[model samples]
Target: MGAKLSGGGGSKFHVEANSEINVTPFVDVMLVLLIIFMVAAPLATVSVEVKLPPAIAKPIANPPKPVYISLQKSGNVYVGNELSSLDTLGDDLKKAIGARNPDEERIFIRCDKGTRYAEFMKVMNKLQDNGFYSVALQGEDDAK
Candidate 1:
């Protein structure tokens, strides 16, 4: 007549912890972001259309030497190898322009690589204000 076994079924329910992360949602979110960027990438680029004049390759007979305006790294301005100050640049440039047809005159601006953009722009603005529209910027030729 020993102890009576407790009634009922012997089935036991065990609870297990899940440590694995669910990456399905994370992958879905990433794919959505990728698609959004792909759709917007091309729209973000901007382009400008310019109407340029027709080009004619011809050598001029006895072409006039272009006027050179050089800007040094130290912000000094030179008008044709002569050191000129900004205040007097207008008068000097005027005299130079007076010597030739303003319509046919082309002024070339040369600036040292180390020169500040603002300094270079000031020279351009001054020339433009003085009615010098045929201005050209001089750049070093690329070594092939």
Candidate 2:
């Protein structure tokens, strides 16, 4: 006979050759879990389809052109139809927004899906720093 270590901080593993293997209970539990997942996986998901109305957006009657900026995966910025550098975007957007009347329009930001979180936050911070209060986020509506 040999001495064995039990459960403790300084314990080590020891085994007796006569120790019977008990895999029946383990297999039983695994089978139950497999069956449970098989039954629950389908019912766990509920699907519903929603319909949306198709209509053109009514543009603001009398307002200034909205100051818009986007952060692309490549980190390119767009003010209008032209691309801009990040270094000058903040100043340029500030000046563009300032040129408009107070009640004319607001700034809008469009972020691409692949854009990094830090980059998006930096763009938002720049917009805020440029004194843009009414900032709108642009996104596509789910065509449900």
Candidate 3:
């Protein structure tokens, strides 16, 4: 026999074991992160603004591979077809570029693959100390 007798009131909770997961908090967090990044993106970008000098685009039929400055295998300097001393290189570069374009905006440095790092830096100092900003390092590597 089954007998039922009830006489008291108490708190109770009924939970469904098969209920779906709630993702509202996750979605809200992602939206907040997206908005934060949207606000921060523009503020993170910075640039060194300079008053650019006037220039003209001149067409070169051959381009001549630029006026190459080279560091010799014997740790010497060469510009164009002339051998120059380290003491005179900076002045010589200025003179060479002045003869062609006084306001030289670009330069190309071609160093031997076997050249020392010190030698390479010395060559860079020659360019940078004289106010040349645009420079390119050119070399070709063997196919792997």
Candidate 4:
């Protein structure tokens, strides 16, 4: 068979352009990310060692009982042992605080793990609006 010649008396070869994707660079980037995360995972979590004072070392005479507000997973709000609604929570809290100074009295909020964040915030807002600023969140001890 004789090869076809172009106008300049030289044979020209036509090459088709490759359309396949190159995944080597993508794989290299993924490996780099994996290594970075592996090195950073241990450093991401850090804990502080604390020495707590003995509970029986010092006892105060008639310590005031702290007010407890709990939010359940079912959207139920509790002011101490009494069930309360969101709409009337502010008024109920005001009555609970009574003559005690809001700044001095500590109000602890215990939220269920399954409770919505919005519901927790709503309880906090209600307490803040009612002049209870010394709010604390109560969490279970991790050791247990």
TM-scores of the candidates are 0.54, 0.50, 0.49, 0.55
Which run of 10 residues does model 3 get worst, by summed lDDT?
Answer: 1-10
- In model 4, the runs with Cα more than 4 Å from the true position are 1-60
**What is the C-alpha lDDT profile of model 4 across 48-83, one tens digit per residue?**
878987787666689678889988999999989889
Which pairs of residues collide in model 2?
none
- In order, candidate lDDTs are 0.83, 0.73, 0.74, 0.83
Candidate rank order under lDDT: 4, 1, 3, 2
Q: Which residue segments of model 1 deviate by more than 4 Å?
A: 1-61
Task: Give the lDDT of residue 110 in candidate 4.
Answer: 97
- Of 3 and 4, the candidate ahead on TM-score is 4
Best by TM-score: 4
Cα lDDT of candidate 3 equals 0.74
Model 4 superposed RMSD (Cα): 14.7
Residue 80 error, candidate 4, Å: 0.3
Model 2: per-residue Cα lDDT over 1-144, one tens digit each? 333345445526544344556788899999999999999999978587678788789876876567778778888888765677667776677566675653445778898999998988887777666556577889989998
What clash count goes with each model?
0, 0, 0, 0
Regions more than 4 Å wrong, model 2: 1-61, 101-105
| Candidate 1's TM-score | 0.54
TM-score of 2: 0.50
